[model samples]
Target chain A: MTVAADQPTALIRLGRFLRDNPVIPLILLLFVLIGVLEYMRPGIVNERWIGNTIKFAIPLAMLAACQTITMLTGGIDLSVGVVATVSAFVVSSLTPLLGAPSAVTISLAAAVLVGLVNGFGVGICRVHPLIMTLGTGLIATGCLQVYQRFVIATGSEIPSFLEWLGTGRTFSLPNALFLFLPFAALILWGLARTGFGRLLYAIGANENAAKLSGVRSWQVFLALYTLSALIAGITGLLYVGMIRAPSLSLANPLLLPSVAAAVIGGTSIFGGRGGYSGTIVGALILTVLGTLLTLLQMPEGARRLLFGLIILAVTALYVRFTDQS
Target chain B: MTGFLKKHGWTLGLLAILLTLLIAIRVVQPNFGASGLESLARAALPFAFATAAMAVVVIAGGIDLSVASMMAVTGVTAAVLMDNATEGQAVFAVIAVLLVGIAMGAINGALIVLTKVPDIVVTLAMLFVWEGVALLILSTPGGGAADWLRSIIAGPVSLPFLPEAWTFWLPNAFIFMAVAIAVIWLPLRRSKLGLSIYAIGSDDTAAFRSGIAIGRTRVAAYAVAGLFCALGGLSLTMGTGIGEPVPGPYLMASVAAVVLGGVVLGGGRGGLLGPIIAVFILRAIRLLLTLMAVDPNVTTIVEGTIMVVVVMLGAILMMRERRS
Candidate 1:
């Protein structure tokens, strides 16, 4: 507490350091490089670009935040991508009857339920989160396929009001964007100050030690997993709003990038460290990378290849920069 | 039987699931009687190879999510080469594919050693890279295979008294996999290097203090994993007779299958054969469901649920073991 009180000055210095980190340049790097590559191309960062970027970023950002928290607690919710797929399948399938709000509520519930199962398995059952989540992810994806085939039927788009949640902008900003950054901040605060969040970190750092010290390590882990699933729910709904539809493959490719963003943002997979703030940077950087790749007209294969390389590079950088011990 | 049950409680339990699945298969279609057994063993091969690949690296306390992608990449290489290669060149392609697996695995080890990045991160990256490369190499759904290669993949072992009653009774994938099992498990159990693999997995720094070169050991494990993946690719191509780019997602699923089969995720524990049982169980269940005419979509959900149940059950078992 004494150090923490005096650490605001230190926090400020750290913030300044982060501001000067290569990631800062990384965020800008995509825009400049894309600008030069697409030279004389109209509307790169104009209203259309801004609109798509913000709307597209919402679901991804939420996913990043969810993964960030899991990483904070020394876990990674591999199930998030498939959870999003399952939730989208649920809500999008129900939109015709429940209207937008009710549909979203139902979908979010399903997402959380899936997350809770993951949390239960990992935190309560003490299964490795990666393997447990991987299994849950498969179940969710399978459920998504079933729901898409049965409940959703093919070729159905979400109702109009549903789309507006992601599409409608405030003061010329996307509604999804406005909500995305605030949600990240709130989660970041919880991680920094809340007892629950601290308990999570303590568990991640050293589970046996945390248990010895009287932390309910399992419960804290359970909560972190639930939060991760909850974020996935929110992301799925946002995706429905933006895309107005769902399919078997809707969130299939999301697993790699979501994980990459969190890890690149400096969240350690081994547990007990990292923050969501870096995750946002990681997400933004990835967003820019994707955006640039599309503008460059690269094949899906090459783009994916670059995607893999970037993840390796950033992780290597993180390992070099941080002292894992 | 009770003595058998006591010594092999988990194995017996797995056998129970396997028996139920076999009975279910017999009920679904009578053809499942004989072919079903052969099919179970055959279908189990690729996943077992993939699992073995996954197990090694995981035993070293790292993961390689790219196994499926590398499988695809290697499969693509084999298909393309086998299509055009001469007899000598076919031999060269085999060597090349194995090398690709090793190089890929080595890259994972290098990144892990030098950067201290997590395996999940590095392997996830490689997943993308490999998937992209595979897609580029084979853009469409269909591809070619050598005629001679198909017969071997499609044929069975020459076991004694097993008449040539369609050796289609035993697919070559099973043969390839049986070879891998003995080759890997025997050495792993008896070798110092293999023992060190378990040691590093339990705690790396301690292993380092104990004179294990953690970096080199991990790197070697990953390389071995890559080679197994390559073998899986060859077997998959031979079994199916085509190289499809679709199964890349199944690589991680295979990893999960291994983990589900009682292999520890962070390494140091579990055996090669345990997960091999899981591979057989999963494939048999999937095949039986198909025979039962369940919707493919629902079948996926069923698979997922089974995985969860397995992991959850495994957890409970481990907890009990720890308590005991």
Candidate 2:
């Protein structure tokens, strides 16, 4: 029996390329999907549609970035959505009293605090990431609901600056697109080029080995979770900006889909492998998928079904590829 | 006694905590008598069954996020089927629902085993799929369970000789739990396959080297989990007396119940009893908050805080045990 490795044929080379450059295939998939959508709906080819797609995709992309970093470390943050909501809620509440700058500062600080708590639980206390984050998320949400129900019956206002950032346009392009480009680049470079990124991959790939090699695993986890929480908070702020109002329901729906987006982008949920580059594309794919479903006049049920199938298929492909190597 | 206590110390501690909470509730609402208890039992049944379903999969070292979605699928199926059927066909309809649940679970098991996908990811994706499927089957919830099924599941059964006020005058939910533990958990826990499930959970490589079929065991565990999820779905149907389109927040709630029960998420560390006890404890917490005039939000906040505190305490206990 001849081994494929011994003589690399065209098929083998193509397979190797697909395996090595997962982002390539992901980008291809995105373009192909866009092209199909464009053909189906001519309006999809316009700048307005492009702006709308990017506008909707921004929050998911930001949330996916958080999920990517945490997942790369072999943990997940289910609390990202709630943390974001709490932080945004805090920002909204404070804006009336503290003004825009201070409220934003306080909002980001609130997010950092949530992240720190998550990190402490997962790291110092040795709770599972899922449980720790989940517990914290629940507590935060419960607090929010209580505040809304009893403490404050009325809603808070969104700062104009945030609204502009969230829904503003520059040169006929969504401002969010500009914001995402740099954010994506920073993360993509950090994951691929920075020492912190290497440590993240090392921890995800093998925590014990990393720990033995002098990496303070707990510290790394603390930082990573904090960063994830901060990202979630920022996403919430951006989301509120886009809609020009705060919503309780915004975060819950984003939770599973953000996780889904990260996984779809080729990031391994188990950690170490995958990149933010793929995740950006993944967020785009999800947005396109939602649009396509709506355009097709399919109900939310069909969209969810397709979402599940896509996640399963992408995950299965990654699994198959990784297994062979 | 010391040795036995050391081995089962966590179990005893959990039981103690449960008792303390129950007593506290009774003290707060002294008038919450047997009927209150009955209502609590009825409310706890669906979640108890959910926790049991989770326990089976978690014990086998696999997590099934799809169980909530599975419950919805099965519930919708049962409701849709029975709503149109007469009294004679309700039994067959239920059988069909159970079979569908088992089949869905088997598929999850098969996908995990064959594709080598992580259990969390596979089940997470399936959660979406099943939920979507449920929605597709019944866009709007308009179906109902048969009268007999509801009465049997939610109604209390009288002990022929017992007074109506006696505590032993059991709700059918309690009977359901007893029969489930007897018919499903007890035999399964003692069986060769059950042992294999644990073996694989603890160390799949070792289990395989010892001649256990990893694939078969995992599939069986998931299949069994599916059966329990189907039961949970039925309980939901009976509780509501109708097919509800929205599954609400039971997915995370069930996972929370399992964790509160002290079942290790990565598997192989807990048993069936903890989850069952934990489910009741959770219900009591919700009930306690409601009784205390606490806002719904406050109740959830309190619940989350309690869960975190308990889990942290559990971790502390384990750490201490390790040190000693």
Which candidate tops DockQ? 2
lDDT of 2 by residue, B141-229 (tens): 76889988888756566676878666344777788776876699889889999999999888899999999999999999999989988
Error of 1 at B229 (Å): 0.8
| TM-score to native of every candidate shown | 0.89, 0.96
- Shares of reference contacts reproduced by the candidates, in order, are 0.91, 0.76
Looking at model 2, residue A180 earns an lDDT score of 77
lDDT of 2 at B176: 77
> What is model 1's DockQ versus the real complex?
0.69
Steric clash pairs (candidate 2)? none
**lDDT by candidate, in order shown:** 0.75, 0.84
Model 1 Cα lDDT, one tens digit per residue, B1-324:
889666566666676787798788887797654455666776676788888888887778878888888888778777776766676677777788788878877877787777666777777788888888888877655455666666654545776667777554565657657776688668766898788888898898899999999998988888888888888887777677667665555676677677767778777876676677777788888888888889887777788888887788888887998999
Which segments of candidate 1 are over 4 A away from where they belong?
A: A1-43, A152-157, B1-9, B141-143, B159-171
**After best superposition, candidate 1 residue B144: deviation in angstroms?**
2.8
Q: Which residue pairs of candidate 1 clash?
A: A74-A271
Per-residue lDDT value at B68 in model 1: 87
